[model samples]
Target: MTNEPTIRSIIEQELERRGYSLSSFASRSGINRGTLSAILNGNPPKPIAIRQLDLMTEALEQPEGHFYPLYVNECVDSDQPNRRRVKAFLLRCAEVGQTECIQEVLDRIVENLSYIPMIFEIGEELYEKGLREESRLFYNVVIESEKYQHSERLAISHYRLFRLSLGDDAEANLIAATRFELYLYRLPEDYQLDGLLHLANAYLTLQKWVQTEIYSDELRNLAKMVYKNYERAYLQGKAFQFRAERNLVVYYGQGYVLKGIALQFQRRYEEIPEYIAGYADLSWFVGLNESGKEEVEKFKLFAKLNTYNLKVLLGDQSIIPEYIESVKKHPPEILPSLRVIVEASNIHNFFIDDILEQFNIDTGLYDRADNYYRLEVSKDRYLRLFYHLSVYYLRKKEFEEGISKILITLKIAISLKNYNYFMKLIPLFERYRSFATEGQLKEYETLLEGVIKDA
Candidate 1:
C-alpha cells in the first residue's frame, strides 16, 4: 500500500484530529510550548531531544519511535573499514575537487554520526582541499556538539579555517565571539598579548567597539610594561597593526587621521611619513578633501635628505613616490632616513586603493534593479563585493542567488566574528527569507535566534 501522508504532516494532522491545540499538546508532551509552536508551524526542530521526544510519544499514546523512526535506512558494509574509511574517501574526493563525491561522503557521515564532531578531522582535511561547503558542514557539526565534551581548540581551528576558506558566517562568528569572551573571563589575569589580540579582534568584529578599544588599550599597556625587552616591544607594534586595521574599517577618516598624529607623538618621527601618507590616500579615496595632506607634507620635509643612518633606524619602506615627489620637486638631497620613508610610503600608497575599495560596496544604491558582480583581487575586497552582489541580486528578486552569496559573505564575517558585517547582513537575511528553501529559511531563523541570544 502506498503511503498517502508524509510523517511530519501526518503528525500535525493527527494532533489536530485529536482536538489538541499546540499549547495543550506541549503541556502534555513536556515540550516547550514555543518549540511545539515552531514545529507545528513547520520550523525545523532542533535535533530531537530524545528524552523530550520520548515524553512526546508517550503523551500521544504512540509506541516508542512511532512518531520518528529510529532507523530511516539500512546500513551497508563498505569495501573499506569504518567511518575513517568514509572520511578518507571524502578527503580524497575533496583533494581532487570532486565536490559531488565530497557531498556524498558528507551525507553518509551525517547519516552515520548524527552530526557529531568525529568527522572534524576529515572536515579540516576537506577544508584544505577547498571543499568549503563540506568543510563548513563538518565544522557546524562540531560546533553544535555537546558543549562540555567538544574540543575547544579544534573548534577554534575549524573556525579559523572557515574564516580563511569561506570568509565568515553568523554561526562561526558567534562561536568565535563566545569563545573569546570565555577565554578572557577564564584568563582575566593573563598578560599574554596574543590572547588579548584575539579578544580585541573578536570584539571588533562583534561591533563591541568599546570593548575592542579596551582590550587594545590593555594590550598596549602590557606591551609598554615589557618594552625594555626588544622582542616584547616588537609585539606591541604587531598589536598596533591589528587594532589599526579595525580602526581603519570603522572610523575611516578619523582613525587614519589620528593614527598619523599618534605615531609622531611616540617619537617614532621617521615612521610618521607613511602614516601621514596613508591618511591622505584614504582621505582622497573617501572624498575627504585636503584632510591629512598638511600633516603628511610636514613629515615629508624631515623625510627628505636623511639617507644612510635612517635605514638602520626605521627599517621600513614608507616614504616612496609621494615623499620622493615632495623631495625631488623641492630639490633636496634625499637622506637615508628619508629613503626608507620613501620606500615605505610607496608600499603604503600601493595598497591604499586595494584597502579603500573594500568599503565601496554597491548595495543596489545607484540603481534599484540590475544585478552584477565586480571582482577585485584582494580578499578584503571580496567582502564588499559579495555584500553588494547579494544586495543587487536581492533587489532584482534573484533570491536564491542572493541568499547564497549573502550566506557565503555571512560565513566569512562569522569566521572573522565581524560584528559590523553581522549586523549589516541580518536584515538582508530577513529580507530574503521568503525566497529561501524551507531548510534554508530554518537556518536563517536559527541564525537570527542565535544573534539575538548572543546580543
Candidate 2:
C-alpha cells in the first residue's frame, strides 16, 4: 500500500548519505549490533520499543517525535498489534498536533490483510472512550475496506453508526438506517430481532410513521415466535440456554412502547392503555430479577408518565394528580421524560412560573436531557417543547419571544409532516393575536393562514 520508505530503508539511506557504517551508527546510537541487524534485515520485521526509539532518534540527530507517526503505522501494520502501546501512541499523536497522521496511518494499513480487523478494533476502542467522530471514521474505513463485508464487525459497525447518527441529522439518519438494514439483511434469521428494533427506531425519527408501524409489528411478531419456541423447547426437555440472553421481558416491553407511540400518533388513543398495561406487566417481571431492578423501576416511572399523558387526553382527571405526584417524586435527571411532561402540563395549566422553573434546574440536568434527546431523536418532543415555550412566553406577555418560539415549532412541525399538531397551533396563534397590536395581529393571521394553505 503505502509508498513511503520503511524505517530500515530510511536509516540505510541516512547512513549511505553520511558514509557511515552500520556498526559505527549502531555503536553511536548505543543499540546492540545484532539487534539492529535483525531489525534492518529480518524478513519478519522487528519493532523498536518507544524508549530505545527515542534514544536512537536523538543519537541520529532527528528532532523529537519526528518518527512517531511511522511508529504508530508500524504498530497497526504489525501482525500482532500491541493495542496498549498503540493507543498511547495515538494519544501522543493527538497531543502533538499530529492528528492528521492518524488518517495517513489508517489509509496505508486499510488494505493490509491483518489490518482490516485491527482497524475495526481500534474503532471500537475509540467508541468506548466516547470519541464517536473518530470511531465513526475508522468504522467507515472498515466498511470501505470491504474485506470483512458480511462479518459480525460489519453488522456491529453499522448498528453503532446508526445509533451515533441519531437526533443530529435527518440525512445522516437515512444513511444510518440504510446501513443498519444492510447489516440486518446479512445477519442470520435468529439475530434479526434487535436489528428490526433499531430499524423501527430509525424510521420513527424520520417520521415515516407507516414504516415505523410495520417494523414495530415485525419486531413484536418475531419476539412472539422466539418466546413460543423457547416454551416448546422447555416442554420437550431440550437444553435451551438462550433465555438468559434473550430477556423476553425487556424485548416485549420495548416492543409495546414502540407500538404504543405509533398508535398514539395515529390518534388511536384507546389502544394505548392496553399497551401501557403490557409494558407495566413486563416491567414488573423484570423487576423481580435483582440485576434488572433499576431498569424495571425506570420503566415503571416511564409507564406512569405515559399513563399521565394518556389520561389527560382521555379527560380522566381523577387519576391525573396521582400520576403527577408520582412523577414529581423523581427529578428530571433520573427520569428525563418528566421534564417534557412537566413543562407541557405547566403550559396547559397556564402556569408561567412553573414553566420557568424548568430552566432553574441544574444546568447539568438540561445537558443530560439535551444529549438524551439527541440519541432518542424525537421530533415530536422537540416540537412540543417549543410549543410549550411559546405558550410560556405568550402568558408572560413577551410577544416577540412567544412569536419566535411558535415559529420554530411550526417549522419543525412542517418538517415532521405533523399536520395535526400544526392545525392545533393555528387556534393558539389566533388567540395570541388578541395580545398583539393591530399590525402584529394581521401578521400573525397571515402566517397562520399561509401555513394552513400550504398544509
Q: Estimate each model's TM-score.
A: 0.32, 0.64
Using lDDT as the measure, the top candidate is 2
lDDT of each: 0.48, 0.66
lDDT of 1 by residue, 176-266 (tens): 5565454343332222444555555444434455665566666655544433343344445543223222222123322332333334323
What's the distance in Å from true for residue 276, model 2? 1.1
Worst lDDT 10-window in candidate 1? 368-377
Model 2: CA > 4 A from native? 1-46, 50-66, 72-99, 112-114, 128-131, 147-150, 188-194, 224-248, 283-289, 333-382, 388-401, 407-455
For TM-score, the strongest prediction is 2
> Against the true structure, candidate 2 has what lDDT?
0.66
Per-residue C-alpha lDDT of model 2 across residues 1-455, encoded as one tens digit per residue: 77988766786787788777768878888888888777778778677666566666777799877877667656676555675666555544544556567776666556665667767787778777777776777778777776656787777777667767765455566777876776775654445676777778777766677878888888878777776776677678786545223455545566777888778667688888887886674443412355456556656766878877676555454664566566556645323343345454553553435434544432333344434333345455666667776776777778877776676667666665566557767777767765666765566666667766975
C-alpha RMSD for every candidate: 21.4, 7.5
